[model samples]
Target: RGSLDLNLETLSGNLIAQNHSFHVLEKISFELPRVELCPEVLKRAKSFVLADPIFGKPGPIDVLIGNSLFPQLLTNERHSLGANMPSALGTIFGYVIAGTAPCLSTAPRASNLAISLLSTTDTDLHSSLQRFWVQEELPVYDKKSEGELACDKLFETSHTRDSQGRYVVRLPFVDNLAYAKLGTSRPIAAHRFESVERRIHARNSSPLKALYIDFMDEYEALGHMKKPPHLNLSAPHYFLPHHGVVKEHSSTTKLRVVFDASSKTSSGLSLNDVLLTGPKLQNNICDILLHFRLKNLVFSCDIRQMYRQIKIHPDDQRFQLILWRGQPSLPLSTYQLTTVTYGMNCSPYLAIKTLQQLAQDEGSNFPQAAHILKHHSYVDDLIAGASTEAEALELQQQLIELLRLGGFELRKWVSNCPKLLQQLPASHQEPPVFLQPSSDPMFSILGIHWSPVTDCFKYNLNFTSDAPTKRKVLSLIARIYDPCGFLS
Candidate 1:
């Protein structure tokens, strides 16, 4: 059966010879339920038979045997019987029906040889009789009627977000042997570690950008003021509330509101009202520039929920928000912010002022701290830069105090500036040293592991291994067959 010919001509001859034997029985036992035969399949097969009454008759011998005997009944009600039917029966049945019992009596060829041997019981007859059989009869390979191929489906479990705020599709597993050709199998299974590493390494020319930050477009037509205010805030000056949009020098580049500003009335200089003026920005930027130029490194850290730690100004607590039909609404005084919101204009400035005050106080104990960080700077967006590791550490210690005083907690999985990392000779690049905790959970920006003790950062290296990376494996399967590729 392994090498048995499956051609239309060969199958036709066998049917003619078997036709006589088929009529010998009045009603053959099918061993299968009659309902298992699908009307649609039968109708399709019926097209191949001759219109002649004698040729059209499906007699006892014509009854298909084996598992496929009931394939037509692959419906839900009769599936049990059909599912167990032997596969070979379906193949043979399909062949007979497709060949339509060709009239070999007029022109007999290898088909005649096949027909002549159908009734014989000789074991070697198959090989000898097959010598006249045409070996290259084209097969239709019509799987359309066979139904969709059974392949394991990979589903996206969560709404994964990309940098653009679009839901990203994820394929956690690599296409393994299960997806290979019927008999083709591979020795190793794919994982994401290596592929992810290679993708990271390929972008070595530039520093990685923060995943949480993005360039915002401010130039799009501003929404009509008539709709409804999404946020409620109390303000003396027109402080853009957090999450609000503001225009920069250019219409194309709009700066999103990260903080809010307010004036303190009848107050002696409290840190809250010290508007982060142009002088302050210049001072902070200057320190940042100095460290970056000298040390060839600069990094910023964010306090986890920095504003949430600050008590709302007693006079300003009235402004809060209410969610109505999924939209924020209501009076300004009632909307209490649950956490530090990033779009407020004053939050960043206030946060910076607080940090500076805290650093000044902490530096008093260790006078060298202020000197070491003489050029280290920040403006709510905490940047630490230094020519030497010792300088960075001194700054880090001061920043830690600043964080503590401001009541903002530091995340352990945070990252520091790689440019601040101590340069190593080729001889010592493989130790697990730490410089600071990562600010991002995914570590998309750092591109390497940072250790504080050894003060070292190492490039990730899973790209070359057998394991596939999240990004690279995604890219490979993407090239082969991206789901969106079809749609596009």
Candidate 2:
């Protein structure tokens, strides 16, 4: 939180954190007043230097030290890394490995790295990254942390295998949410709900109502909610109902119905305030992008409603409650989200973890699809290309089936292969939605526009009446997304 030492480079020409655009920065050095080894032990240290802040702002890492120092700091620390480390520093992280799993390197020696992190990037730029995880396996994960324990609660007894040996998460169905604990139904929570209710009534717009209907329909269809019971024994948790802002999709309006998890009950704790934002999941965006080249027969597809597929554990469903009514004239009804919800802090972890778990569960039967599912996809979007059309088609079929085992569906398929696109029904070949004008004839592959018919990437610009100054032009130019670095 203190002011940062702005000088960030050593004249010796080592890259502290340089991109290829990295010209030799002005040499510099600085000593930290005290790099805390622990609250008890302090090491006055010399760090090479932080680089110029991207966009003139400090990065997540305030200081840059050599990798050699990592082995020493971790080896000498008597307590688990989570303890003793000041909460202000947040936490240390490495990178994503298999299916939405973020890993930290804990071992001191290079030999142990392979065992601990279990994955590596495939190209030249990540060579240094490969070194970060080279050390040995982590010490046992028995380190007690509120975050760790919360994650532990997920794996406790509720997960099992189906007859097909697919891992299935057993979700709890409840007439209502339980709130004896967490002070969920207390007056303060009710007040928060009242505030949301007031806003919806005040707006009273048709588009807003459409969003509400879409949300309630989906909620009921999933069996994650239902009509209020006439009578019930347990005091189900009462979560404040809130309508998400309306988003215009094509011509249709959609509402993201969510419970105000951050709303406090009389207990003064919002659901988010109490929950841990579990371990980071999902591979690096760059890692995912790097693999999506137009090698030969490339294709991409999105996992429909990625988060809704993972069913929350029944024990945990009590935490996801909402209040709502189908008609404004009707009384507000209580409903609980039986499945994982979008707004909850833990949703990403649960969803990604569930995906990774599916890959692990079925990898043996479908190796190629599993590999793409694990390392190649960015969350639900899968980008992969094969050396031949036949190979790509085979990969596509296997991918669809593999995901289906976990109650997931892969749709919105697009490909450079005409045969592949033409062979599929009209639904699969539906023109790229909202990506470009129909006249432009471009298909979007993870934000890059390409001509699937021509098998080449296309770049186009739509001018919005205003001409820009030189600096503005440069800024706009940089906004374009090109992951292959073909321009470079």
Best candidate, TM-score: 2
Model 2 lDDT tens row, 77-102: 12222333321121122111111111
Count of clashing pairs, candidate 2 = 10
- Residue 45 error for model 1, in Å? 82
Task: Candidate 1: give its CA RMSD in angstroms.
Answer: 29.2
**What shift in Å separates residue 458 of candidate 1 from its native position after superposition?**
19
What are the clash counts of all predictions, listed in order?
A: 45, 10
Query: Candidate 1: where is the Cα deviation over 4 Å?
Result: 1-287, 296-300, 320-334, 338-345, 366-375, 385-395, 410-488
* Clashing residue pairs in candidate 2 (N, C-alpha, C atoms within 3 angstroms): 9-28, 11-27, 100-282, 109-135, 112-135, 112-136, 113-135, 172-314, 177-236, 177-237
lDDT of 1: 0.32
Tell me, what's the RMSD of every candidate?
29.2, 17.2
